[model samples]
Target chain A: MAKRSFLIPGVDKRLLIKDSLKAMPDFTRRRFIAGGASLGALTLLTGCDVVDSSSAETLLAQVSKFNDAVQAFIFNPDALAPTFPESAITKPFPFNAYYDLDDAPDIDGKDWKLEVRGLVDNKKSWTLDELYKLPQVNQITRHICVEGWSAIGSWTGTPLRDFLKLIGADTRAKYVWFQCADKDGYNSPLDMRSALHPQTQMTFKYASEILPRAYGFPMKIRVPTKLGFKNPKYVVSMEVTNDYKGGYWEDQGYNSFSGS
Target chain B: MASLTVTDEQVGVTPAKVIQPVWVRVMHWINALAMILMILSGWQIYNASPLFGFRFPREYALGGWLGGGLLWHFAAMWLLMINGLAYLVTGFATGRFRKKLLPITPSGVLHDVRAALTFKLGHDDLTVYNYVQRLLYAGIIVVGVLIVLSGLGMWKPVQLYYLVMLFGDYPTARYVHFFCMAAICAFLVIHVLLALLVPKSLRAMIIGR
Candidate 1:
């Protein structure tokens, strides 16, 4: 049913737009001003009337893609994010995520399996104990947040590059996408180069202790070379793929390849 | 470069010199607009995680929100870098920097500072820059370059670790970037006041006389 048209049958479209504009004082002032700029640029660039907020957002979204390319271009696979000494580690490293500390997924290691999918030859899902049996390396590195805060924490895990190699993942795949256990199904795509970075890890422990609930129990992808969000937490599965599947934040305008 | 000068026939006397060329005028306005957008959006970004306790009044900010602020900031970043680079390259290529901002001695700068404080500094020849003006312009240019470099260092700290090291660290680079922005803001206020104080110079920039 045409519910909106039923209230005011055969309403003049132009008058409807005009009256709506009059009602939206804040939108007319703030969004219109900002939206008008991108509208102008978009009109020039695309040669069409993309006359709404979504279209303007589209223009900005394109810039994020451009940033992804630039980030990838500038990214040095061999250049490591600097490691800190034990003394330099921030005391009580801050727990951060889209959700509150209480809401972190209650994961049982016995039931939780690290599912390997996509191009990896080894599709076996490893239990927490099995995954922990692999070689572990530790590094004290800064976790830089998108909001401009940073903290140093020591993480211990199997190097993702070595892990991927062991799993017989296709090295030429463009992305290693992670699926998390968060309620929102939080996920992220890690670029192949960054995925293969020496420091990238399938982290199992933080500060010599089993990963806490606040810090993603069972697993988290530790990507020191990237912003915090890129390091997916409570990671349940990882797919080695050539496709470009956007992440929760990346889909919402955060740069895809937000590598430092 | 071909100069845009009024011939003696047009003025019916001596040919007039072009104080600001067309390219310089275009680049100046573009840089000014770009810097304004950058600073305003940057303030919004700063408010996300403030260095100081106080926030910039919201009305002065450009973007409506953090995401919007970032979009505006990143968009203007390209404009500022490209235009600033062109300005510097063109300035050096034409010896404009040397001609307009040279001979800045400690005594000369001191003399101009005294003259400026006493309101005795003359703006008779709009073509010529006083020692104070010269220093301010040169200082701002350096600040502009540093801000871009520091921004790059922050943007890719891991990739550009060498550059970050030169500035001490990531946090220091951020502080340097903020201070450079403050310097630019200060220069803008003084530059605008001086322009309004001497309208002919402003007209020279606009019309390129």
Candidate 2:
């Protein structure tokens, strides 16, 4: 058996002799004063009712200037959020909401196609199977909600950027619009910066299961960096354009640029 | 030791005239505690969304802390607002406003900016405030007000009536609230760093100069 030894700072026994020689009156008095001051401050915090209005107005004015300065400071052409490893994901996510799938044309794989149109030289439609054949990207990210609940899950899909590249997305295009099927009028605008986020993919599988109807079955969109509302579900068709047409939430007054 | 001529009531040095009046001190601590609680509860709220791909859905459940966190947060918020208002009143009535928190001129701000860029601080004569501190303190107050207004804009859109148009609507107000909070977090990072950089300046607030 091994014996363990640890270092500890032991109190010196000579403190009693030192204390006897020191000015005990001053020491005790100072301690008492300090204790009293702490009590007084605490009392002031709980009992006092004395906030000055002038300070509020002055502080308010100073704060407004600061807000302007911040707005001026944030001028950048391009920036992006990072993607995380799939291993960090949570599995078997509970389905909360789904949208725009019922109106999807129930054509067979050969006939079913996603149309990419508006503001692009090469407009084309790709079949769902064709989309699945493309290079895939998987990401694990937390989905934040406005109602204040969050879920972490693994999403597997092809990046929207890749699809846009395949269609030769016009250089002037400012927004990518998703026109979905279930027809509860689901659509959203994805700006350039967010459209190219590495984690911003069109998701198919939520966990290991193919998406359920309650969770945009078959396929859906996922925008990791923004709020969950930005990730429109039951995605059917996509349109890339420079003009900002109102989407479902945009019409409801959600921010058009909800980048994290 | 030989103070025969000196009276016990010798008033040569008045204890450093209380620069931070009782009201100011009360408001400071209340605001501090309230802000901290808000952040913690806000996190529990944020936990549901984790805005930037961070989530701890089971944290509160695992730790048994979510409910208490929310209660503390809302309760402190009320205290924060009341104390903040009280401080505002005291500042105007006591005329302690101009005495401390002197106005910073553009040139003074410019010099402070340079000092901040160079990581120098607390040279009171040369630099009024390291630019970052002035900017952060100033920004925090603005963000705080925005949060309150935007929160109202969301919760009582009908009452604030005019805010709906300014911030867009409920969802937009939510965005503003979230964005302002993000700004606060950014300020907090810098604030903690500055606190570490200059200990005495941080102490001045607590010890009343």
Candidate 3:
């Protein structure tokens, strides 16, 4: 049999909605109960939005609390940034906003010095050449950006531990501070767990070549486990510290614990 | 009463009720959530490269985690697809699509268009809805389907070869997905405003009499 399609003219479909209700003459007790159950389900779904919003807030709070616990434990006077192997490199990293680095020192390679100070037994400033004379470390690792991008690159630099030992890190210092030449004046606060990860370290090679100066020029701090913003570039000084501190992006609304 | 003009001949109008059944309402709210999640996660993916100047920090995610964003989007997409299809099928089988939701006639469309434009021109007790609401609802349904189809085209280019061919290429499919999202966002803005303008409209959908 050929089906005749239902067609209505000049009346909005919504206007005729009541007709559907009228057709069900047996709006019995069971139907009412079923309808109620469905309505309850509808209400529950409506509350999902609010539930999702609160759960997100709770997660953020927990992350912050975890960072706080790490901050409370104190032991070593100085810590070193971790080193990585050269085979695990990533590519195509982007420079973050350097809103804090505009007015800093020019850091000419000739006079560049990495001042190691504060809470250390021996506060000393080592020239770039002197610092480079130490054991060099290299690693290939992903530079995950806080802005949602990832790049793997080979980085070459002296082991931060080598620098710490040279300056005679005391038992009181627990964190290392990086003072960058880019005027960013960015300081990173790291827990011992991340500060000494084997895959974490400073680097100067990218894509199997000398690292571009545009990345950080003379030298940069590389913490592979954290977001790229935490890896300060054009680093001028490495301060050993027992006191807690934060970096450029951290102050401008970034996670201090920024780890995997 | 007749002298006082309370007669049916004097007014010649009757109110027609609009009922958004439990199934339709549940499906609607779920669809809304899924779309919102898809958009939020999409923004996360887009932030990887700011095609425009806008940027959202990777740490800040709608789902509070970058990985969670992707998971929720995919999960919600499946739910929306299943529920949407169910709505369409049940709507048809129960004859509700034809009797209450379908607009298969030219005059029906014309009346909707006219009523949509001239808000106050209809009789005071007219139960018929103007065309604008139907048009918007129909648009949401159509665009929703397109977005899902285009999404599949991107999700599996080789498997969904026919769907991808419809859009010509993968990038073209992405464009369709993006524009459909824009349409949904636009509709939402207008829908909310209209709801505010006519307060009883939203209540009617939620607590139908």
Candidate 4:
């Protein structure tokens, strides 16, 4: 039998012993030991030992993965984020991004083409007008930012699920990655569940007006259920793939599935 | 020890009763630690995007960044919820909730408030809880439950739509969560101060009298 040392050093052993009278079940202990072993394996899998910061990053990433699994398991596809009336729309919706508004890329809408790649059957690129011709839907939903503030905005666009169906996308793929035209290569990946959400749209208009450059001019993926960063803006290309392609902020330690 | 004796003399009493059971003492300390960690880390998470105009000072918040803060918050959240549930169940099973924590009357509360305001409040009995103590404890427990529900609403707004709707909306739920946290913090301040002022009461909770 392996010696188990779950308690941290310098903790009050008397209290712990007293508390452990309400013992956990045997299966829970076994599962926890297995989890701990996998955590060690994860550290090794990242090709780093405990001495390096990479090990810590790997552990954080593993925890994030666990979080993603828990969230996905609990997610209800049919459920929707609460919608608000137009009267509840926040006026002067705040513009937020890694770059300043003035530095937002000014792309020629007519010249832009949305390149499609990976497991989709139809690999034809899409023009903005071509996308606008798809069945459109409007929703007034709250845009929650990780930074703590939220604003309600009216958005209109084709649902990404509908678009994926049009492109004959392999809907069972694990990830849907987006490549954005924003500076510093701002991009994000979405889980298949979120990608298929009815509210997940390839947004063209905001607040009944064509999306301003500050809000992703050509197009934005409006995912109301996810935190703001997960909804990548100015998207130029999309790939449906089984491979794990880490995102810009995700590589920096933000959880890949940052659902609020 | 000497101060205790002097205080006993001043109050004309002797402390010998077992005021807190071992379970109560254990649960109390665990809850205290869990709440402290949760508040500190919650502040760190809140600083990521502050509700108000300004952010909490970075030094006061726990967990270095948004990621670290979330980790701490989630871990402590489980600790708090589970331990809190155990405490409640054990408290009821042992009749402690009925004998010590319950039966708070509005008039008794008013009397205790007046006594406190008039500086006539007594701490002669370490084995029994005063009306104010009972009321505050009951109020904090309710607030703790609200905090947990509101937290769930914020964490899974879609799955827990009814909970979110109870608070009006998602942003409003966040605000309510913050407000409940502040209320618990305020209760903690008063609780700690009262414990210090009546040192024997603190000792009773620690060593079970």
lDDT of 3 by residue, A79-165 (tens): 322323554343345545544334434456777666766767777676766656667766665565654445556677765555555
Q: Is candidate 1 or 4 superior in DockQ?
A: 4
Assess the local accuracy of residue A8 in candidate 1 as a C-alpha lDDT between 0 and 100. Answer: 26
The DockQ-based order of candidates, best leading, equals: 4, 1, 3, 2
DockQ of each: 0.15, 0.05, 0.07, 0.21
| Model 4: colliding residue pairs | A147-B49
Top lDDT hit: 1
Off by over 4 Å in 4: A1-64, B1-16, B117-119
Top candidate, metric DockQ = 4
Q: Compare candidates 2 and 4 on TM-score and give the better one.
A: 4
Off by over 4 Å in 3: A1-106, A165-174, A204-211, B1-48, B51-209
Model 4, A1-260: lDDT tens digits are 43333222322344555445336677876686687896576335334442465555555556566767777687765578888899999989998987889888888999999999999999999999998898889999988777667899999999999999999999999989999998889889998988998889999999878899988988999998888899888999999999889898887767777776
lDDT of 4 by residue, B59-101 (tens): 8786578877776576567668888999989978988878887
Provide i-RMS per model in Å.
17.8, 17.2, 17.0, 10.6
The runs of at least 3 residues in candidate 1 whose Cα sits more than 4 Å from the true structure, single-residue gaps closed, are A1-56, B1-15
